[model samples]
Target: MPFEAEEIRIDLMCRIAEDGHWHGTLGLNVDAQALWRLGLHPDQPTSVVNGPSPPAWWHTAGERYASRHAVRRRHDGR
Candidate 1:
């Protein structure tokens, strides 16, 4: 089935861990059907692969994290 185009917004918050690693909370606001079409479930965690050269926004506080990490979905929060 063809997927419908919709506007989605995601917000993320990053923090430095005790080991100096970066971790964060990701929030996604999208339609459930749209998410399914993208092979993603609203109740499961999702992993993202960062390329060698990512956007400048991905880097913060001299820390370049998110090389490859999983983001969990927040029920009743998104």
Candidate 2:
């Protein structure tokens, strides 16, 4: 959310899954259009799902900034 891209902004929408888990929708704002994608794949394999940004000053070589903004899923006790 702290990216310097003014032409594009990412917005997240919270939702509850059928299994009672919380999920978020990743949205891209471009030219007054809201394009959205959904998922909670936070591992390394899905790293490019939302695109990658350079690591912050405090991170190491293999570290990335996009890792901080992951879609957290929660389970509801029935």
Candidate 3:
């Protein structure tokens, strides 16, 4: 089985707790970074992203986006 790799973006709101660690959430009603991807999959239930507010910009890590992103499972790309 051959597979190709691609990247995806996701956003989440995180907070520091009294335990001295960071915590994030994707639940409803929060200030999460929020998804701005294309190919609407509203029924797909996002397990993973918001990238390139325009879907054509900042598609690589070299741009240093502050948001969290998902990459190919076996990818070693930068």
Candidate 4:
């Protein structure tokens, strides 16, 4: 039998560099059960891995000078 997939929405507040100055928010659609297995909760504060920066000039500002040091979860005014 085919099973339906369950998805969850999460908000991430990422700090792309060590300076902790530049930050951005991202919305993610992830597998609900997988997130639960990994101990992730909705509206929870957590750290995530950094991906490659976008090719735009403004997007490269934070990544040009320094590497992506860390990422964190953000609360959506809940």
Q: Report the number of the highest-TM-score candidate.
A: 2
Q: In candidate 4, list every pair of residues with a backbone clash.
A: none
Which number leads on lDDT? 1
Which residue ranges in model 3 land beyond 4 Å of their true spot?
Answer: 1-11, 28-78
Q: Could you give candidate 4's per-residue lDDT for residues 1-78 as a string of tens digits?
A: 011244546687767656655767778777755554444546444564223323486557667645656453463333
TM-score for all predictions? 0.29, 0.33, 0.22, 0.22
How close to the true structure is residue 11 of candidate 1, measured as C-alpha lDDT? 87
lDDT of candidate 4 at residue 19, scale 0 to 100: 60
In candidate 1, what are the lDDT values of residues 1-78, reduced to their tens digit?
A: 223345466789898878786878888777765655444655545563222333465455235444355554643343
Q: Evaluate all candidate structures by whole-model CA lDDT and list the values in order.
A: 0.55, 0.49, 0.42, 0.52
Clashing pairs in 2: none
The regions of model 1 sitting more than 4 angstroms off are 1-6, 31-78
For model 2, residues 11-70, the per-residue Cα lDDT tens digits are: 999988887878777888653211212122333343334444444664453355456665
Q: What's the number of clashes in each of the models?
A: 0, 0, 4, 0
Residues 1-78, candidate 3: write the lDDT tens digits: 011122333457788878777766654432222322432346444653443343334445535553565553422334
lDDT of 4 at 74: 60
Candidate scoring better on lDDT of 1 and 3: 1
